[model samples]
Target: MTNLGKWTARLAVIVILVLAFVAMLWWDPRPHFERVRQDHVVHFVVFYALMLSLVLSLPKLPVWAIAISLFALSVLLEFVQPYFGRECSLSDILTNLITVAVATFPIWIGKTIRPSDN
Candidate 1:
């Protein structure tokens, strides 16, 4: 694929992921009972995917910067849930951060071990 095609594909995926994040966080209409036991698991997986997509989508940027930005976005989204008929939970923020950490830790470690040629 051409450079332009690769970037366009990445941009499209990032946009879809961002929309998914917003919709899931702000507009989720699932019953509380259904989410009680599995909420953190959902958060962890979604954020993990988001983290990996972001790192791949923006390769020129530092991984630490991407992780920090994801954390900040998570915090912001969690805090504003109340206005959107959702209760904000500290646990979600913590889970999101933990997910980011888990998602990025291996990348950081691999770089440490291999020291990327770039």
Candidate 2:
């Protein structure tokens, strides 16, 4: 990756972190979309998008390394969820890993289909 791509990828990581903080920590009076939030389909789709973003942001990293890091990250987040007045479930952990694996299919197939930096 170019210097700009690395910086952009790092910025994306920060954005994802911020979004995670908001999604998992902050409480608000607005409609919480509980149904979708709890749905396995949503879990699959959201984490798939998330892993895809992570891969896109840091393509220089080894694929297995990314997968392992993300797996650990998910476990850590689940462990943290209880403190934030949220319930943690093994199902979520399973969903996360599965989604991440499914999401990375494109990368596993061949060279990644990256947008031109030109």
Candidate 3:
């Protein structure tokens, strides 16, 4: 397998860190959309990208391990959010877990449709 190098992994981690900091610290001005929870959606999308980035950067690791690790991190971060003055939500944690797992779907699709160099 071709390596994307350690830098891509580092970049992914950096993006996740920055987004998490903003997400946990800022009081969301608009937290919903027509009864759907916006925060939960944000958590889902953000974690999805995070999982993909991590796997792209660390292709040697199993996707299940990455998903589990990132899900745990999401849960741990939620626990830590209260210290930063943000309310923790089990719903959000669940959303994070689900989206992280969904991250593997795109990779699978991409591989299946990817063109052959030969």
In order, the Cα lDDT scores of the candidates are: 0.80, 0.70, 0.73
lDDT (0-100) at residue 49 of candidate 3? 66
Q: Which stretches of candidate 1 lie over 4 Å from their true place?
A: 1-34, 115-118
Which candidate leads in TM-score?
A: 1
2 versus 3: better lDDT goes to? 3
Write candidate 2's Cα lDDT for 26-107 as tens digits.
3342225675454565556557657767777767788888888878887888798888877676877898899888867777
Which order, best to worst by TM-score? 1, 3, 2
Looking at model 1, report the run of 10 residues with the lowest lDDT sum. 22-31
Where is model 2 more than 4 Å wrong at Cα?
1-38, 112-118
List clash counts for every candidate, in order: 0, 0, 0
Clashing pairs in 1: none
On lDDT, the candidate that comes out on top is 1
Q: Is candidate 1 or candidate 2 better by TM-score?
A: 1
**Model 1, residue 26: displacement in angstroms?**
15
Candidate 3 stretches with Cα past 4 Å from truth are 1-36, 106-118
RMSD (CA, Å), candidate 3 to true, equals 4.6
- What TM-score does prediction 2 earn? 0.61
Ranking by lDDT: 1, 3, 2
